[model samples]
Target: MISSTQVVTLARRPRGPLRAGDLAITDQALPPLRPGDVLVRNTWLSVDPSIRIRLAETTPDGYLPPFALGEPLAGLALGVVVDSRSPEFAVGQHVSHLCGFREHAVVRADGATLGGYGGLSVVDTLDHPPQWFLGPLGSSGLTAYAGVHAVLDVKHTDTVWVSAAAGAVGGLVAQLSRLRGATVVGSAGSPAKVEYLRERLGLDAAFDHRRSPLTDRLAETVPAGITAYFDSVGGDHLEAALDAMNPGGRVAVCGAIAAYDAETPPPGPRNLFQLVSKSITVQGYRAGSYNDLLPAMQREIGEHLAQGRMHYEETVFDGLESAPAALAAMLEGLTTGKTLVRLDENRS
Candidate 1:
């Protein structure tokens, strides 16, 4: 009998820091394999800004249901198959998706292929860390691709601005915009992150959001005004972007990390009127809403990763016991890109 450790939800409402009491780690015995199911030993657990939203109560029309207290806390993950009863996924297949936070999982054979979609092929590690599956080559990459290419419709003449530009999605957006021949600028909270963007990510320009007035720096950085804004921080960032957008500009709302842990999110864009006067378009998007676009996204991002056109960053915690600290660090902007927990040490 394989003993597995899993993170289970324990709170009905999470108002501030997600405490140890909010999640319980427990052991469970594996059940007998059922037909068409495959057993996977998880290696990585993704800790994302979206997980905070998933934990909160929302309207019935919400894209996903709120995580139930006392149930396994589910999120995106990367794993390897240890056993299989299905022909599709044999033993040792590497996989990544929205699996619960556990050392092992019994996923449907189709689940291994991501809802049985043939276009999404699971590749074995290619000299890259398994954690990349949760970042650049995975959901974060797709989010950046869809927002810049589809929603914003960036062109060679455009000037792009990305908030939280050193993050997984924002960094990818900065790279994609540069690829499209657009001038790219980004805003980061620290001097280190700003340096990472300018020196490492090769952004056209990067500003320290905490030290500089965003609107003034934006006006100086792009005298012609921003034609596309990949918004990840929201609040003041959103207002500043709105104030600097040129006519016919497009804003792709990817995430609002600045407001995720707040007891109350600051009011929405104060400069929304700019959208009307400048004839700008603002659209909110979720990567899960664009599964049909995954094939093309995967192919494009894969090519970039293979050719060194893009780079991925991650802050990894060593064990399930470090989950809370990992999540807290991510929220505090102590991480450069994706944040995840490594369960290899605790695997059965």
Candidate 2:
């Protein structure tokens, strides 16, 4: 039985980019597991941009509550069950749960889930690395899957633009659209990420959004007009997409990273009227609501991984101590692909 563990806690709310002083690694005592509780030894922690939203004083409606000062941060994590009081889970089983930012977590097998995600569940690593479960095969994959198939309804004939295309979710969306024979245009913050989209991911066209006005970049990359868009960055990017969208275009709004770090929400796109004029469709969705599509998402992405038909990338920070820095870097677009924290490198 675990007695104590170190966890990352919110030391204070940050008005801008996160700094180490805003967070602290504190030790806490764990109580004896109750019946139906599963204790896990966490191996990998996911560092996502969405967490930035929660660091603010308030979150958007229907989203998770903000993290209070001195409370541990929760996120998607992969761990092996070390002790179990529940018949449903066995010791040594690998499970994914929301009790991350700590070396060990005590999960209630039947407890409430975080927006239908981060519930205690078993997972098989199969031939892939255990960490991959936290990346392409896990939440990131599910998000990309839902936005493309369930929301955007991308078709082969449609041209699609994926913002933040070099990141985890965007990269998958781009490749998935391409697999259906759609022409895919991607935008990233850096020339290197643009090169990655074109040379590594084989995107139809790619551009650095930071290099010029997004409207011009869109014209240069997708002059024919895109029929579909998978949006992560919301501000000017959404405005640009709206301007470049063809009549009857579809937009799957997953996140607003452009405003995640802002002290207050930025202004909405000034061109939203284009939706009415052009008969366009814009929908916002979260992965939790689309749980029914999980199996198909995992199977298809798994096959793509096995066949080498898809490419995935990650920026891993070593140790739990580095998580704060990792989050800051990811928020600044300083890291590429899926940002993650690797705990216990000697173990896995």
Can you give the TM-score per candidate against the true fold?
0.87, 0.97
- The CA lDDT at 178 in model 1 is 89
- Backbone clash pairs for candidate 2 read none
Stretches of candidate 2 above 4 Å error?
345-348
lDDT of 1 by residue, 86-139 (tens): 887778888775664777877776553322322212556577666776777677
Span of ten consecutive residues with least summed lDDT in model 1: 112-121
State the lDDT at 78 in candidate 2.
93
In terms of TM-score, the best-performing candidate is 2
Measured with C-alpha atoms, the lDDT of residue 235 in candidate 2 is 96
TM-score of 1: 0.87
